[model samples]
Target: MFETLSALFFAHVLADYVFQTAKMVQTKDRFGSMALHTITVYLCAVVALGSIAWQIAVLAGLHLAIDALKVLWVKTRDDDGIKPYLADQVAHFITIAAIAAVAPTLWADGIWTKDLAQGGLLDISAWAPKMMLLTAGAIYTTRAGGFAVGKLMTPFAAGAPTESLPKGGMMIGILERGLIFLMFLAGQPAGIGFLIAAKSVLRFDAASKNEKAEYVIIGTLASFSWAIAIAIFTLAINNGLNDAPLLEIMAAKD
Candidate 1:
């Protein structure tokens, strides 16, 4: 069940973030484009959940409604902000959770309790269960985390004239956090420093001035801090869930 849910969630991350192009994203409000996108979502769900036609239909239906609502919401917005992004994810998660809980075979064993623990390291929570945690972190640190950082910088940004970024800062923040999170998972702290250095160099021309420099520092730190915190928590949770059992330890000796 845990593995199944992880597959489903990862499918979502793949479809929504990794596979969906910027062009697709920009045009989702129109019926034809959205229909194409919805088919992709359905295909993802089916691939993850298997050949169950009804289950695929349900997931696809909910995903479409949720995404359509989001497109309309964004279309009406003055400029993009965090709440809608978070809310959209929240609604999708709820739908996923419901399906995970109510679906036939999946519903019965969805929980990741000790009963599912077996098969030495292969069956360990670290290998199977933690995949979900990592995938979820990847998904959240994208637009969702970007939105959070935006909110954090609101006070600093208030009344200040907006500086239009040639490359959208939203996407940049997503990549930054996602990379940092992966670095933490890989146990490579130095990569994060390198990332910061690279980013600073990129922005130095604009941020060399006093006011811009201060804002850049604050935003950069805040983004780094959020990513680092999530990485730490993810590692910690994976460790806890994957703690070695006496049985597994004994088996290791054999």
Candidate 2:
């Protein structure tokens, strides 16, 4: 069951995040152009459910349905805020879980088979499959996290600078979260402290007014909070994927 869920989850991430580009996202929302992107999602589901003809259709159909609902909702309300994105992802993943629970047989014969496991993928570890998931999570945390921060920090935005660097906040959020991700993967949480200290030292400005100071403080705290939360989540999920529960891993020193 875990294997099936992991496989389909990775496929969903690939379809929604990696394969679907910015242009694809914009074009997909239009009523008539939904088919191509939907097919791409189906293709991803097929890759995950290879040779399981019935399951392929099942997952693909469900995926298309969820996506269509999202697109339609976006079109009708004309609100492309973070709410829609969150709703869209939550709906799709929930559907995937429900379908997989009800029809585990659909994924039983796919990628997790012993024959395939020992053949071309003999050298691969469970971590290999998990890497795909972590990569997708990292991407989502950066973009989605930034949008979330922007939304939450709206009233506080008035005191903030119009611009700090070129593509500044977005790029910084991505890099900061990416670094935090690496720190978690490497099991060095102390690195995060150093990162924070470095940022504080650099952005130290005594002459800056109180409002901008408060703005920077809030934004930095928000960014770091998001990064830390995601780092912990990525580590926890990857541990599960590797079949090492967090408690057991924490207990091990040998």
Candidate 3:
């Protein structure tokens, strides 16, 4: 577990660096904004530790809460503007948590080994390439999805007033995609933790009723879809890796 986690950490760091670079390139003079965003996110994460069930419930709850607050705050403050749609953010968290919850079973089934952890962190260093590939894949997939969605919405946005959109739509897009990339690189739980922290800071502003409702709907769908996807992916990865015999071994012990 430790070895896997270590690899995950490195992958996460690398992916985050790349994502940050991309953001800088897109926004130009965005240093202050990025610094503030990172600091705020870290602070929120620190505060979240005080919540009950810090490992499980708190982590997931925090993610949900932040997104909920963000939508609510935005709508309330900018009633005339388009609100930040949080459907994707909510869905990503749900998917990550559901998958992570079941990951232990995969290990038990020998999809990977707890022994992998025993190998000492250095022993697994060779796996960095594979991990990097996974990280890259996640980043690509998330950016692709966002671009596709943006393109689809572009046509309708032409006649629509920009002010009709939420004040932080672009920021939300960057953060949402960044969080997803981080989660894929670092593992789901960590990713969720980061998002919860970021979202908390965003919630200082309140949302309007319609905005809140929209957020609720988007969050609800995203969470549900994520849960389903994680389960499917976990199972698929396990089977594809040919761990049935290991699972049988585990089953017999049980």
Candidate 4:
């Protein structure tokens, strides 16, 4: 039953992705187009029982929350709005910090590890697939940061002041990186999925070439950074020095 259910869920997810991609190709006003596109996707999910029928219903719930936040933000705020950006950033930071703080304890307590061990798959020495997913999220963030830098450079060359370029790029990079890091720490695939969806929406509406380039650069760099960090952290943890202090510092209250 689980296998059949998982397969059906995967099919629904694939169809939703295709439908959104097609809509993006046809729509000129990227922002408006994506807003509508996501709404349609949500409608489909509701009608098809995509959320309730899925094994990972929690993920679906998280995705819904993320999408709801995105819709509210885009509708109420300007493209370069500061308040919305800050609010999102703060939320991301808090989420990541919380995850980093509690994950080690959770692992030690045998909550997730015990269940896997029962299936004869326990390996405390080895990072799980879910951990790999978190690492991927971090890498995506680093890539986004790099992309943002590139985009800002173009505007600088076109006579936009150096100050303005950096400021604009930094703002976007902060939001991107913060969200990526947070989602990774939270292990919320739904939240990450929403971020991916938001990117598609932005792509449809992105006007300035430099802006797009910057976003891409930042994303690329974020991904790279995440990969490197994960590798280093995995090594550190395996060596028996879990680096609890560093983790605590990172997770410390802002």
The lDDT per prediction is 0.66, 0.66, 0.38, 0.41
lDDT of 3 by residue, 103-143 (tens): 42322222123244554223323343244334434443344
- Could you give candidate 4's per-residue lDDT for residues 111-171 as a string of tens digits? 2234464652344323432343334334434543344344434433443324435566456
The C-alpha RMSD in Å for every predicted model, in order, reads: 7.7, 4.0, 17.1, 13.8
Please write out the lDDT profile of model 2 over residues 45-164, one tens digit for every residue: 766655346666667777777777777887899766657666877887787777667766544555544345454323333344465556656775676577767766776657876566
lDDT of 2 at 221: 83
Q: What total of clashing residue pairs does each candidate reach?
A: 0, 0, 12, 29
Give the lDDT ranking, best first: 2, 1, 4, 3
For model 1, residues 1-254, the per-residue Cα lDDT tens digits are 44445556766777787678878877887788788887888777665544445776788789999988887787887444666666787898778767765663442232322243531122233354455557766775665567678866776774332458664666678889989887776767679889988998988875787767777888888888878876665565445445533122111110
Give the lowest summed-lDDT range of ten residues in model 4. 1-10
- The local distance difference test score of model 1 is 0.66
Would you list the clashing residue pairs of candidate 2?
none
| lDDT of model number 2 | 0.66
- What is residue 133's positional error in candidate 2, in angstroms? 2.9
Please provide TM-scores, in order, for all candidate models, with all chains considered together: 0.62, 0.75, 0.30, 0.35
Worst 10 residues of 1 by lDDT: 245-254
Q: What is the lDDT of residue 227 in candidate 3?
A: 34
Tell me model 3's lDDT, rounded to 2 decimals. Answer: 0.38
Winner on TM-score between 3 and 4 is 4
